[model samples]
Target: MKCIERIKYPEFDFKEYKASEGRHSVHDYPAMLHYLLVNHLIKNYSSENSLIYDPFCGSGVSIVESLKLNRKAFGTDINPLALLIADVRASNFETDRIRDVLDRFNIEWNNLTPDIPEVKNISYWFKDYVIKDLGKIRTFLRTVKDNEIFKFLLVVFSQTVRDVSNNRKGEFKRYRLSEEKLKQFTPNVRKTFISLVEKYLKIVETDIIPFTDFKLFLQDVRVSIPIKNVDLIITSPPYGDSKTTVAYGQFSSFSFDWLKGLNPYGDGDLKLDSLCLGGKKIKEQKELPSGHLYDALKNIEKIDEKRALEVYSFFYDYYLSIKQVVKTLNDNANVCFVVGNRTVKGIRIEMDFITAEFFESFGLTLENIFVREIANKRMPLKNSPSNITGKTSNTMLNEYIVIMRN
Candidate 1:
């Protein structure tokens, strides 16, 4: 209830800053947090060696930042690709072993008969020769015995998959290129993969440091129990279900398919978006705890009842995730939920206010909400929420960082 009356959202300049810079450039994660922002939050809210947690740690930005700052970090996500990317980022690798392995892989590449992966509609997304080249790389990776080395190679391969795919660039959703574009799109998959591997290797050689206390899990926060005594929680939760918002699963579908052998979520069922918050339909809708949410839901329902149900389901799941997260907080622990106020049927949902209310419902005190411009967050500028062509709405231009304490 306190700090709720004087709610002033101050704008911060995050446009000029880079989120996927330096070592963080290992992979291109959609809508990743700025490294500077996560660093500031971790340093300001917690002390050295304290336990930090991120329930929805996309690409493990918070995990990598926390480990670098000498904090013990824990992160979880439903996306298998997210876990793999996060694990690779937080891990320390030997440059000599990597270089030696590459040398060996190059020698074996010419003689190796690449078996194309059983990714559904593989040809649609990749050219015949390109598929063979990627398969060769995956085949080479099987010879790798070192776990860290294998993970690093997987990250490189994942990036290569995205680059070579017919999926349109600069999009989180899966949209294949046009026939003309596909004909003109001839990507050197092998070169791209090697170049990326070397690029990340250079970064690892310089930025490699040991942080043994970090942990990354491929688990849903709503059901998984986080480690206790968490001193700080810094995360950017999904603004809405992946289908309506950023299709994270769609974005990683190719990578996930390539890495399916190691995928924790299993094979064939690549419904990452469906497994996300409010990804599925609910049997009944109930009034949530926040007044802001209630008003927004009513307004959206008036326009379209089905869309409102989807909205309600996402928040309900979000609330449940928050409940599990709150149980792990230590006394006086700090929490930061970076979120966006997305529009549905032209009705803006005040996610920041509702987030504050959810924390308050769980006996946490609201501190502040910092509004930052989405200078470089990789998201579409406009979306057709009504599903009507030419009827588009502007996505969130700013993100809200809601601070609270338990």
Candidate 2:
């Protein structure tokens, strides 16, 4: 079947789309859809050595898919933990060496002493025994000589922290944990770490590992990078302010606080306060719109101007950063961004429209827009509310795949 016929507008049957054979399906996102899009670009628009890029490469999905197709890949993220995961997933490593490191990690785990000062927040979330066990594992990880293996182990440990924490598995926001429940399933940090390492090892052994050049950086998309001429760019920027739809910072705080040295109040270059929003004063700066649509939304008057400005400014900064990165691409390069609209004060701000305006400002032509239904596997029924006025409304239910070209 033709590709265009396969991608029917409004009602693409994504359930029937199976991922490429032998591709590990552990990561989130529609792998088959992303594979089809990446494959299409490679077959029609790319040369053998074309450089593919994903600025907001969550879990390294686009870069991993690109590598499987023999394309050089570049990815960056503000989250250090994310960078570590991407680096391990994208790099070539010897299985035996990985196992050796795991063995050493186990030995070190057994002999480790919890001498390091305990983080106050860590103590607050985890029981005394749980905190001590986690601290021992983290301390051992710090002493590992193999940086790649250390990072992989870190990912394993980080992923397990959520499961072991008092936080509910399905809910991504902060929640108080009952002492009884915390005592029941306090994750054995070492045991979970070993199991996760083995699982990752099995995935690496079974899946196809295509030979392609790849790089991962703990850098923000808003800044310039070393790559001069990218051929294709694929990314999904953060959904406006972190507090709105997806609390990425809060969701990943366990790892971020331990590894990235993030301040509990978010006092870093990548903090939520640093983003550009339309209504709120962020970093002491007045609310400013990056485009007309945002300005129009700000003029609604019914919406809290301060809050709306903060949200708009955050998104605007992220959009502008992505635009700057796109500018570094080759003249013939194509860029695809996955984003969704968010509502404030019952007014839906068309994020896709705002993104289109930003891209147009960079002389890029809009190629296509694909709308996908919101299937949040993690937070399936947690926040079904369409409005956030009382935290009882389901605010967002759809996303847009905005495709453009230089």
Candidate 3:
């Protein structure tokens, strides 16, 4: 087989890592870009000690690959669960230690009575017995003094909640089971939780954390970042509002609410789905320098004004976020935004073109745009162009890798 560093563009295929499962399933990123683009950006800096930062790290692919290369990685996300999953992914622990924690919990499992945590409309999301078992998991987790152990157990518990909740599997937004479907559905929460815990343990044994240090922050990139002078950035920003493009908030809500229910702000309390790029409104008086985004918005407005507003709002805040991230980069440092151009009301929103314009306005130079077919990404497969309710339309199948430099 050819050596990894020697593999070049067009020749490399995602089939090599088709087994991108397990913890990888915790969030979505183009598996190919995570491997290829990350390596490509690392090649920019000659020093092995260079810092790699991802503001919108999502599931932490950028950080993980940076560590694999023995580089110090720093990442932050507005979503706490994303940070938690990234923390679990980057966790440095021996298999024996994890197994011991679980074994100890199992021994004390009989003594602890199931106690449910408070959640908003708890009954609407879970069955009573499922709630009891979730409480059992939370109670046991609270007893573990080790932070690493606590985080790993939390991942298992969060996954368990998603699997057993009334929400349909794979749907981002919370949707209750139909009355007929509810009549027949039954999930054994305790058994499912234990099985998932064991499954994650096996994955832990095989994972190797080669890097020595990493810093993960729970903050919004649109507001502030804790670190500065980042050498490189590799991130996949949201395509549009969470409501239309991707329901990141919806996808993560079940797990987030459970974490919040256990403790108001200890785990998660942000309305992430609604707090993202297009989540809130921002006024934009100046016209975009490029005509593409402007034209698309006008067309969308003629047909669907609500969607037009969502797109406008997303770009307005997204522009500010890009401005903030650029300030943290060193002179001549490279930034790669792996993004998709999704359609709304049959008009394509050219994120690549728009991103390049934003970078230019900030006195940065556009390097190159690499187009690649997205591979090994799990999406709902179809989404409506004009509906926030999610209608059937052709989903995003390709992505643009827009690389820019200061």
Candidate 4:
């Protein structure tokens, strides 16, 4: 690795520092950026121990940032992988168990081997020897008595899977490497995992506070969220359905495939991406809370009614999720969303305008809509919005913040 400093971000006036100690760039939305929002907008109730909630807490950046500021952080998501990361990232470490684990693993590294679980085309995703090593690490991790250490270790393992897998890097969707590339490539899974474990452990030791109040759970925002009297509801939610938006499910499924067996959960958790906003099917909805979306759908209806219906369904689900967020918040509390409006069939859907109007319908006054150029993008710059070839554009160049009051 090389050391560099003073990188430039176009127009986002946020700080340039990092958040989590480990390489926790699972999804972008830096801590300093979030802290800036929390500091600037949330003036009414900025208590040190204020209850902060993020309903659609993808990767738990908001929740983690809240904890860092000595606030009570809580978040809910459908994906167990996200919960695991959030729990590990937000929680401060206690004992030197990680050191002990690392010491013992140094001696047992060669002897240990992976007990690979059953997955579709596992050979294609990972090499045979890599599988063996991963299985061994899994076996060793099972023997670990401490649950807290185990969770952080899972982050290391998850990163290892992503790093060593045949799936092309950077792209959220999993696509196996070409036969020539696969043949030529060789990865030292054990070394990489061990290095990451050390890095994460150091982060826990030096960065995290002794104790930070946080609760991360696997729950759909459209259904239920166990938070109340929330001081601030800040989140950068899923843009739309994961299929054409961002392949968060596909990005997480590889790691989750290995992790799900460690605990007892069904295939429902595996469908986290599909369970995202607008994941389900529905008819074209004209009965919209916001006229902006309805009009956009009308324009889209002329082009492709099927895709138009998809937008309606997504907003319908989004509307419900926003309602759930409102129910859990205290009176006069604020809800802010850092959302990117992706184009469908090359039509720019104004999520910021739509969200502000929808929130107004819920009796929440629209505070302001702040626009910022996306400096650190987690997703690819170019993509097919309609999931059809030749219908592509620059997706996340700019992001909008829709702030509303309860």
Clashes of each: 0, 25, 2, 5
Q: What lDDT does each candidate get?
A: 0.83, 0.61, 0.72, 0.71
Residue 365, candidate 1: alpha-carbon lDDT: 92
Return whichever of 1 and 2 wins on TM-score: 1
Sort order, lDDT high to low: 1, 3, 4, 2
Using TM-score, rank the candidates from best to worst: 1, 4, 3, 2
Best candidate according to TM-score: 1
Best by lDDT: 1
Candidate 2 or 4, higher TM-score? 4
List the candidate 4 regions with Cα displacement exceeding 4 Å.
1-12, 15-45, 263-270, 284-286, 381-393
RMSD of 1: 2.3
Assess every candidate by TM-score: 0.94, 0.81, 0.88, 0.88
Could you report the Cα RMSD, in angstroms, for every candidate shown?
2.3, 5.4, 4.9, 6.2
Tens-place lDDT digits, model 3, residues 26-100? 433222244655666676542587888888887787787788788888898877777788878776666687788
What TM-score, to 2 decimals, does candidate 2 have?
0.81
lDDT of 1 by residue, 221-276 (tens): 87866579999999999888877676778778888888878543343245878888
